[model samples]
Every structure is written in C-alpha cells, then in structure tokens.
Target chain A: MLEALLRLPPGPVDLTALDPAATPGLDGGGKTEGKAALAALGDPLADLQERLFAEGRADVGHGRAVLLVLQGMDTSGKGGVLRHTVGLVDPQGVRITSFKAPTDEEREHDFLWRVRRALPEQGYLGVFDRSHYEDVLIARVRALAPVEEIEQRYDEINAFEAEVLGAGTTIVKCMLHISADAQRERLQARLDKPEKHWKFNPGDIDERARWSEYRQAYEIALERTNTEVAPWHVIPSDRKWYRNLAVGTILHDTLARMAPQWPLADFDVEEQKRRLREEVPVR
Target chain B: MLEALLRLPPGPVDLTALDPAATPGLDGGGKTEGKAALAALGDPLADLQERLFAEGRADVGHGRAVLLVLQGMDTSGKGGVLRHTVGLVDPQGVRITSFKAPTDEEREHDFLWRVRRALPEQGYLGVFDRSHYEDVLIARVRALAPVEEIEQRYDEINAFEAEVLGAGTTIVKCMLHISADAQRERLQARLDKPEKHWKFNPGDIDERARWSEYRQAYEIALERTNTEVAPWHVIPSDRKWYRNLAVGTILHDTLARMAPQWPLADFDVEEQKRRLREEVPVR
Candidate 1:
C-alpha cells in the first residue's frame, strides 16, 4: 500500500502536491513505530536479498538483479536511507556508488557511459546515491547542457531503463522529496554541530538560493522520464525513518515477487555428499 | 593481547602449531561471551570508522585508509567474517572485493594490477576476500606458475605492500586458519542443505585432496611475506564466533590507533548559519 502511494502519480510531476511531513500509507503512527516497523522488515528483507543473490549466482532465469536508484535534494536523507535500509542486506550482495560531479574523463563520454560501467552485475542489489537523473535535474537547473540536449536525456534515460529491464534487472528509482523548509533545518543542524561540519558546503547555500528552479527541474525530469517499465517513486523524506521504511518495503516486496529458488547443485549432490563423508580427507 | 597473539609470529609461519578452534587471547571466555563482546563493539567500531572516513574525506594527514585482507581455504568462512564483522561499519565507508581466479586479461598484467585498482580511497575501509597472496598459495600448490616465478612473487608482494603503506593504507592481512577436519564438516553441511548447494564445488574435493600441499604453500607464503609494515594475522577460524571477534578486534584497535579527527569545517560556519536563518529563502 505504501509502495503504491509512493509511485510518481500518472500525470505531471507536482512537488507542491506532496507533503514532505506526511507519512501517507505508513503502517505506524509515529517515528518510534515507523523505526520498529523498519527493524521488523530486516530479517525478511535480508532473506529475500539472499535468495536474489543465489538466483544471480546460479545464472538462472535470465539472471535477475535489482538496482535501486536514490535521488534527492541536498540533506534529504539519501545517506541515511543507504546506512539504514541498504545496510540490512549483506554488504557482499550490495554495490553502492555515490556519484559526484563528473571528472573530465567522465565528461568525454556520453552521459550514460560511466553509468553503464557502474551497472550492478548479475546477483547484486545496486544503489546509486545520485544517478543519471542529475543530467536533467542539475544539468537543467544550472544550464550545463543546451536545451535540446537536456530535452533528449529524458527519452535516452527511458530507453536505457528499458534496456536494463530487458537484461533482467529491476530498477527502483526513488527521488527523496523534501521541502525547502526541511532543507533549511537540516543545513542549520549541520552548521550547528562540529562533527557535521564536513557535510556542509558553502555552495549548498547557493543552491538553496535557487531552490524553486531545482524544484521545477526535478518535476519536469520526473514527469518526462517516469515510465511503466521503470516507474519513479517520489519518497517524502522529511521523516528519515519513514523514508527508509518505504524504500526497504518496496525492495523487499520486489525481491519476494522475484521468488528466486534455491539453485540445484550443478555438481552431483549425492556424489559430493559421498566425497564429503568418505573421500575428502588427505592432509 | 589477542591482537598481539594473532600476529603471524616472528619466525617461520607455522600453520600446524595453531589450533583452529582456539580462542587465543579472546577477552571473552567463550562463544556466548564472544558474541556479546562483538555486539558491544558495534558503537565504538562504527565511531572509529566514521572518523577514519572523515579524515579521508578531509584529505588531511596523508589521506590514510585501512585495508583488511582475508585469506582462507574454501569453506573457511571468509564470507562470514565479512558479513558479521566488517558489516559492523557503515557500508558506505567500507569497500568489499571478492576476487576469484584471474581472467586471461588479468593474467596478462602483473598480479597486483587488479589489486592496486581495488585499493580503498582515503576515508574508506577496504576488505579483500582473498588477495595477492593467492599468487603464492594456489599458484604454488597447483604449480600454476614456475617455481622461480612463485618464489619471486613473495618478494614482489612484500614490496607491493610496503609501497601501499607508503601511500597511506594500513594493511591488515588475515589468514583464516581452519583445519582439514573443519573444512570437511563445512563442505558436508553444504551438501546436506539444498539451500547451500550453490556453494558446494566438486572441484573443492580436488583441492581438499591436495590439502597438505596447499597448507605448505600457505606456510611458505606467510613466512616470506610477513613484515613489520604489514604482518599477517592467523585467525583460528573453526569457531566462526572467535574468528569474527578476532578480526573485528584487530580492525577496531587499528582504527582507534589511527585516531582520525573530525575535520574543521572548510567554510565559515557562522556565515553559513546566518545565511540559513535569513538569506536563502525564496521558494
């Protein structure tokens, strides 16, 4: 139910319509309950991931894998979601890449080239801290690309997602939606604490100054690129616990639907058992 | 005390002398106590890792990092140590690499080429499931390389590690020591459980048959390459709890010694605070 509520609604993507403070469809009444529910999802979530990993390693049924793309404005709890939600699964089964501003070499290729290289191999739950969507969001807001090129990235991204799906990877694209007011409090908190100092950037204030532009950019990017093949989910992230729970639940349900079976032994099981019982002793 | 005891001692590396089930110098007396002690390490371990990560991010003090190398026979629980011990830290700050047999492309280059590429950046903890020592271990045991070449690799590996230390990574090399008997039980357990079938390899039988040779190779490799800069720790791994606890303690203490400071804010905090409170508000 929460997963359905989180999906980017079927029309123009409107940020103002969603309340960052609202925890619609959440099972719990408050943060304490929400966190407990999140903890509850861990064991089952870890089991599902193990099954999926087993399926990938077996190379069974198209070698299915899941990629969860996390996109959010500054201080919208993307790192928190990664630390809490993705952390539940075995780190061996998960690959996390936090994309920063591109280097000169990365800029030499097509926008998707570096992304293609970073695609999670078979049997992994891949997470992107910020993803290719930045091309449309930051690229548009900052006019880093010409209008036509920026317009073209949406179709390119959809086609890319289709290709990723065709390769048997499920993409869960999430935009952590936070209000400007929430952003202010988070930034203020960072400035107030000495330990949080490393996270603060003066440029963040510059971006905050152009908040409305970034909001419009995100809306247009989501609206144009959101597709049935790989739908975008706008997660209200002002509540860190709710954000993590929503993402974890969606991922858990996705793996369950996959229903990866225990791969039958490629080796002769009885023979291996016999060897273990009788033969495998030399040293 | 355990850290000092576990260190590959000053003379020849002697696998036969170590007890696979021994919880040598473990502060906790038994499994129940060990498990609780390891669990208690969660907060302190997590804090130390965050500091190391912060230092790396700050690019201060030589941009230091820690690399934990895990080496073991099959069924020796390399994956277990990763999941239970390394998993204690934030996944974002930990990079885990599980290396298998090198491909033809990898073989074309020097052995440490792929390894050098996999080193963790400053501000991250790196774990290698199996590492360059495999060049000497299996390569010598199976005669995959000429005897002279395998002998040369020991020197090359030592020099490679010294260079890595010079470049700011503190390497923690651990050999998960499990007896042949322990290996057989683990293999048998895999054969017994259908869910674990994916892990069993018939070829493991082949390797087990050559167990004595592999053990000798490990001794030689460890003897030649053990150095003051990056010494090997032999983790008696028959008991998974002790193995995890030992590895966790070594890594935890290593981080504590690093004592990475929370970096000073690069920008003016007061200026950013004033701006957050007053100026950066439009949308």
Candidate 2:
C-alpha cells in the first residue's frame, strides 16, 4: 500500500484522479487506532536515531543520515505531522528546518544553496517543512521566474537530490494532499479561534484563488523530479490522524532499511580498563 | 531547596563546601522516585515550549528565550542532563551548541563571538554543552594565557552575560559537581566497554592528576563570575539520576517563573471567520 503511493511511474501525473481523503495504509482502523500505530513507532525510531547519532560521532567516517521532506498546500496538516510524528524522537538527534521566504542573502544564491546548507549532518534525522519544490510550484504559478527557467529547476533539483542520495542521505518526500473543502474548513477554524488567528494569513486566500494553477504546477514538478533516488509520496491528508500515522510509518520503514549500528571502539578495551583499575584512585 | 543550590551570595566561594553526592532538591526520594519526578515534568515543559514557539512566531516581537549553560569536569554527566532534561521539550523550540577545542576561525574572534552566534532566538531554549567559561577555567589551570589576562576574563564574561540578559534571555548556569573518585570509576567504566572507549581520552587522566588546581580554578571562576544576572547553580552530580532530577527541577522552576503565555491574535477573529464562511468554497 505504501509502495502504491510512491510516484514511480514515468509519465505525467493527474492530481484530480487521486482521492484526497484516501487512507490505504490504515488497517481498517479509525483515528484512535492510527494514533496507536504512530505511538508504537516511538521506541524504534528513537533507538534508530541514537544508533545513527552514535555512528556519526564515531571515529569512522562512513556514517549516514535520513531526510524527511514535507510539502503540502496551506492548512494541509504539515505542522500536525511534525508535532505528532517527528516529535516522538529525541530533539538531540533531530534537525528541523522550517523554510520561509528566502532572505536577501539567500535570494542572492541559487535555490538549492540554502537547501544544501540545511541538509542534516550524518547521524541525524532531518526534516524540511516546505522544501525546494517551492521554486517550481509557487515560482511557476506566480510567474516569479521565466517559464523556461522554472522548467530548468526540475532537472536541477533531480541532479542535486541524486548527489545527496549518493552521499548517504536517504530522502523521503511527502506531498500532503487535501481537498479545497477541507482547506476551507481548516482556514475557517483558524479564523474562528482568537489564539489561532496568528496562523491565518489574508494572503493565503489569494493563493487559494489560484488553486488549480498550483495543483497543475505540483503535478508537473512531481512528474519531472521524482526519481528512484528520491521518490515523492502523495499522502491523502484530509484526516490529520491518518496523515501522522502514514508519515511515521514511512520514516520507520526507511530507518529500518538503513539499520545504523552502534559503532565499536578503536582502543584495547580490556587493557585500558586494567590500567585504570591499577593506576587510578577510586576513593 | 533548589534555591540553596543557586549561587546568589556576593562573595568568594569554596568548592569543597559542596558535596558531590548531595540531593538537596529531591524530596528524600530514591533514584526511582527522582526519575518519576523528572518524568512528570515532561508535559509541562512541552506545553511551555509550544506556547513559547507560538508566541515567537507571532507578529509581536516581545517573545523571550531561555539559555541553559552546562559546565563541569569531563564525566560529570552534562550529556545525561541534556538527554534527560532538555530532551523532554520539542526540538523545534530548542537549539543546542556543543563547544569543543577552538578551531582556527573560532580562535580568531573574541571568545564570546561563537557563543553569541549560537544563542537561541526568541522563544527557544538554548543549551551550551560546554560554554565560554572554559576560557577562564582550563586556560587558567593550564596557563594558556598570562595570569592577569585570565583574571580579566571573569569581568568580561559578566559584562557579556549582562548584555545577553538585557536582550530578554534568561540564563541559567549549572556546574555538575562530581568527586575525583567518581570520575575514576566513570573513566574505568568507559574503558571497560568497547562501545564507550571512544569517549575516553588519555589526556583526561593527565588533567585528573592536576585535580586540585582545576578545583581551585573552578572556585575562582564561579566566585568571580556568579552574578545576579546569571547565577551559577552547583549541582551534585555523582549520582547520574540525582543530577538529572536536580537540573530538570531547576529548569522547570525557571520556566514556570517565566510563565510564557499563549499570545492573543491581533486580527478580528469573528470577521475573518464570517469572511471564510461566505467567500470560501466548502465542497
């Protein structure tokens, strides 16, 4: 079921054909059961993260890392996924980057420049909230750049991700798919609550007006950039519980496949211990 | 009881007066109960962190931050405190910097330059694994600088911390006090385990030989630098569980005093909700 969600086909994609509320990964379970499944993943993810952290800090230099990229429409539960899924692990071993509009210094460089700098170091679980796909998505829809230049970003992103993959970072890109109706309800709820109004942006309504264009932009970007090295998983995210569960499950599977180990020491352990007992004072 | 650990007295201090095995903050509880008490703090810490994060991300610029500095001898359980205490909060709201031996670039700047760069942004909980005090402690003990120069750093650090406090950041400094006998046992244990040998440095033993000098150095540094703006808390750290509990309790108390609030939004909530209901499409 997880594999079915991965964008592996070598053709143009249709966002309209896929159901926005599907939960194929759920085992005929409701929100409670999905949450339970997510909770079950906590120990394993933490254990894997510790091993990865230890490996990265070990004397040897062959350590690896994992990067989880989350891309979605506004109010589509990216924050929910982060709070519920990645929040289970220890913060010491995790690196999270929330990408906002590029700064003046960032704008001076290529799009990938900031993205590359934010990549997780070895032995960490890196999470990106709205990644470089923004270059081709919003940049395409808003005509922030030339159409041909936006077209060039797809291949550029693909090559850059391939380089990262070759350098021992496992990348899992998730596109949280939510219906326009679901987004409307979410936006309404945010506006209804005084404490949540800080999250409600008036400009988000303008972005919603160009929804079809953004969807088309996402479809083309996913079709052009999805590769065996880094596949895009289009997750039905209308149900926040199922979205958290699915993302957690994907990350668990990815770390399991990596199987980072606790590194062995490079010194003569027995001899060192014997010397310490013989020479050092213990009270 | 926690107040007893805070170095609020305005005079010279003696390290010998503090017992490394004391558990002044614990309620006469054993390790099991102390662990449970530490565990109880998880929810409140997480909640405070979320409020801080939300307030920081809001348009208002009045959000404040907390910076916890962990300074102690090697094998004094700084790592344990970090893993057990600060680990309870969301990584998204925390920024940790582990200061190591100075590099060429770091040495080129004033000692506080690297530390200033790593200070947490508003609403974050910043942690320094080993901080700028090393310039006074190790540099004094090892005679890396002239005696007059090393003596001057205590005043410099006090002024630097005063500036940081003025910027709306609460600072807590903790010295993980441990016995030399405990250090020997920890070093031996590290040497006995193959996986732990990487943490064992032969140079540590050389430093251990000059333990009294190091103690004297710490005493002068703490006495001179402890100020109302940033008082040092000398935590008993021979027992790892007690150390974790004491530090966690101190942080919990500090943040509770801060009382970071969930910010009220600046927009008109009812109007925005009505606009969403009328103008937005909902399936």
| TM-score of only chain B in every candidate structure | 0.97, 0.95
lDDT of each: 0.89, 0.83
Q: Give per-residue CA lDDT, model 1, range A1-283, as digits (tens).
A: 7888888876797799899878989644899989999999999999888878887777774768899999999999988988999999899888888888998999999999989988888888999989999999899999999999999999999999999999989999999999888888899898989998888889999998889899999999888888998998988888888899999988988888888787888888998777777784466
Across residues B1-283, which tens digit of lDDT does each residue of candidate 1 receive? Answer: 7899999876787688889989999644998999998999988999999988877776774879999999999989999998899889899898888888998999999999999989998889999999888889998888899999888998899999999999999999999999999998898888889999888779999899999889999898888888999998999999999999999999998888888888899878888888777883567
Candidate 2's C-alpha runs over 4 A off are A1-10, A61-63, B1-4, B61-63, B143-148, B194-198, B280-283
> Where is model 2 chain A poorest over a 10-residue stretch in terms of lDDT?
A1-10
Model 2 agreement with the true structure over B174-249: per-residue lDDT tens digits = 9999999899989988887765665787777778878888898998988898898899888889989888878887
Lowest lDDT 10-residue stretch of candidate 1 chain A: A274-283
DockQ of 1: 0.76
- Residue A261 Cα positional deviation in candidate 1, in Å, after optimal superposition: 1.5
Name the regions of candidate 1 deviating beyond 4 angstroms.
Answer: none
Candidate 2, residue A16: lDDT: 86
Top-TM-score structure, candidate number: 1
B55 in model 2: Cα distance from truth in Å?
A: 1.7
